[model samples]
Target: MRTEMFVDGKWIGATGGTFASVDPATGEVLAELPEATEAEVNAAVDAAARAFESAEWAGMLPAARAHVLLKAADLLAARTAEFAQLETRDQGQPLAISAGFSVPNAVEHFRYYAGWVTKITGITAPLSVPNVDYRTRREPLGVCALITPWNFPLMILVWKLAPALATGNTVVIKPAEQTPLTTLLLAEVLAEAGVPAGVVNIVTGGPEVGKALVRHPKVAKISFTGSTAVGREIASEAGRALKKVSLELGGKAPSIIDADADLDEAIEGNLMSGLLNSGQVCAAATRFYVDRKRADEFASKVAAIAGSMKLGSGLDETSQLGPLVSLEQLEQVDRYVQIGRSEGADLLTGGSRADGDLANGFFYRPTVFGNVTQNMRIAREEIFGPVLAVLPYDDADDLASRANDTDYGLAAYIWSRDIGTANRLAHQVKAGTVWINMPPLLDAGAAWGGMKASGMGREMGWAAIEDFTEVKSIWTSLA
Candidate 1:
């Protein structure tokens, strides 16, 4: 299928050129999408700005906005399978994961945020002067720019777009060029659900489309999810324009397996958590911390489960793991494995590509490495593969220190039987999201974001909805 850019509530051919999205499985062209130019990006932003400034939208009550948002949510939930299949083909995430996990997560974000469309509240302040009465009212931030990554395209798209729209702000989204099909399709869902034209739009392309949107004067705020390097560029541009920015960047998250933890349960969670989506997830648990006594046992179990995982096409009924997003990513993962071996980390299991039998697809065997130190290149950097680095620790304090040593802290996992210890360690770790015995993604109402180099700003929940809105103080005098 050929896809086009959404501008001013209509799908039109790109003025610049056309680009093809390839299926990572066999390197076949899945679809052709527009290479949006500077002009097209600016046009989408201008349309969103005009929509925001219009009395038709700006003057409407919160209830009216809520009605539209909820309607969109219902339509999205009904069409979950269609979006999930497209996502699996384009992004290389398993159809089961995309359908059972990502699509539903996206729909929840819409339905939950839909409820908040009319409930935005502001506080009343005590006045110093008796002649004046002051109160606050929340208003939309006009135009918002959303730039989502290739991994979990539909889910991350919801994370960026839901609150921006639910709070009554108009938005122009720039989904990753590699996998923008689901998002461009989502624009149709919004219209079908009753969201007005110009309220939402999708522009897809590489760096230029992203750069143009970020630097545009019409875009009041930007919310992005991608690599740390690209996030830096976007943040710098936003700084230059004095525009608001929210970023959910990269991570090399660590999971600690305490001595008092359930070894079997921990091993199971560790194996499946990172292997989900073939470990392309930003918050994927890549590093495993265990007591010295349990390191050997833990490594064996992790390797066994990983070795047994069914690897094939995302659409395969028995496939639990899928290919990486691209052949480029497969090469990157292999290079990192080589780096680990050269750095003296023991290759416990899976050190090569699975191209022997799966020659037609981009497939790498699930990898596990042992005898890893905190200082190794493999442990420190993000491999973005189905690779695990199991590190041994002597004490809890030492484990905590080592876990915090990484430059990225988007998410962390703790597998322990003791509630007190889990709660205590959870407080010490420097991550936006900390999981205790659970490695799955969270609900739509919880605030999800990262700290440090992982980027800033929170999305979801009541507070996150407010992130898309601006509060104004109104003062009146009654003489």
Candidate 2:
């Protein structure tokens, strides 16, 4: 079978060159994907532009669009096992995470957005002219460029595609070079759902393809999810083109545990948000701040839980924490442990890679550092691993200030049973979303994005559809 780029209802090799998709876990070849050239990206954008301009999708009723999306969601749900297995093998995410979490949530996103397709409406203007009436319209942008990350490929793709398609825009998505197969699989399901040709296409490659999509004149909007470094570049280039863009970038989220919080529930949120998907998650709670008096207990509890998780192949049901997405990622996580030690943070437990039967893959011990200060490297920068650094603070004001110190404002977590205090803290935290008493739980219709460099604009919800669309006012005066 061809493991090439998907363009305009067909799969083919790259015009310029080819690249290999390596299984980051075993360091083996998964498939040979096309290294799409600038010309190829331009071509895909052109196809999308043509489809959009011709209104191949434009004239379709919103209910019709919703029907197709719902059908695709159903198809994906039925093929859940297949996509889950592929996601596990390629990205090294736990099979349970892929199968039980990301995959199911992906389907949910599609189904949710599908319902919104017909529900999105524009209001009639209250006319000042006696005989003249005015109206507003929400129109889909002509074409969009979607760029996804390796960490939650299926979920992120759905986040991009659902709103774009629901709003009646065509798209040319560039899947991350590391994990492209599941996206290709999605293309198959989209076609089976009766989406029109050229309405949605995907190209696989590295920087060149992404560059092409961002700069292509035919593309109207670009929605990207990746590291902040790359996101900055996309925003810069897209700015030059004067195109619409939405980015969901990097995050170094914090989970603050106060004196009055439920210790058990807070620990559960910390682990789930930090260690799920091997800490490859963007909003993973990497930094933990606790009350000074309870700091020791919190640190010990977290360490115990981190040490107890099973590490093995994602396919193994017993495995809770899977391999890091790549060897480089594993090394990066380990390096942070070293950094934490060097920076004078107390190494309570788990400061090395997991040994024994799990040593074959890129597995690292889920490390924890106590007495971590805000200035410490691990607490400030995004480690993007299963390592959690615990810091202690005396008061709410200090904790709030420390939490908002970083440039990232993607998401933050606060744990306390005091709803009033939690609400006040949530208001002060510099983030797009703050979850109190919980972590990383996204409602299907909730708006998701970041402040500062974490990213611009937002995704999910009917409000997010506004990002993929354009608003125009129409007036007719009998003057």
Among the numbered candidates, top TM-score falls to 1
Cα lDDT tens digits for candidate 2, 157-228? 998898899889999999888888899889889999989988998888888788878888888899999999
The local distance difference test score of model 1 is 0.87
In model 2, how large is the Cα lDDT of residue 158?
91
Residue 121: error of model 2 in Å?
A: 1.7
- List pairs with backbone clashes in candidate 1: none
All candidates' TM-scores? 0.98, 0.97
Which runs of model 1 end up more than 4 angstroms from their true locations?
Answer: none
Candidate 2, run of 10 with poorest lDDT = 1-10
Candidate 1 lDDT by residue in tens digits, 1-479: 33988888898887778888988777789888889888788789988988888845656677887777788778888988898889989988888899999999998888898787767788889888888889998987889999989989989888878888777788999989889899889988888877777888888889888999888888999999999999999999999899989999989999999998999988887776788899998888999999999999999889888988888889886888888888888999999999999999989888888876577778899999998999998898988889999999987877778998988989999998889989999999999999899866689888888988998988888767777888899999977
lDDT of 2: 0.87
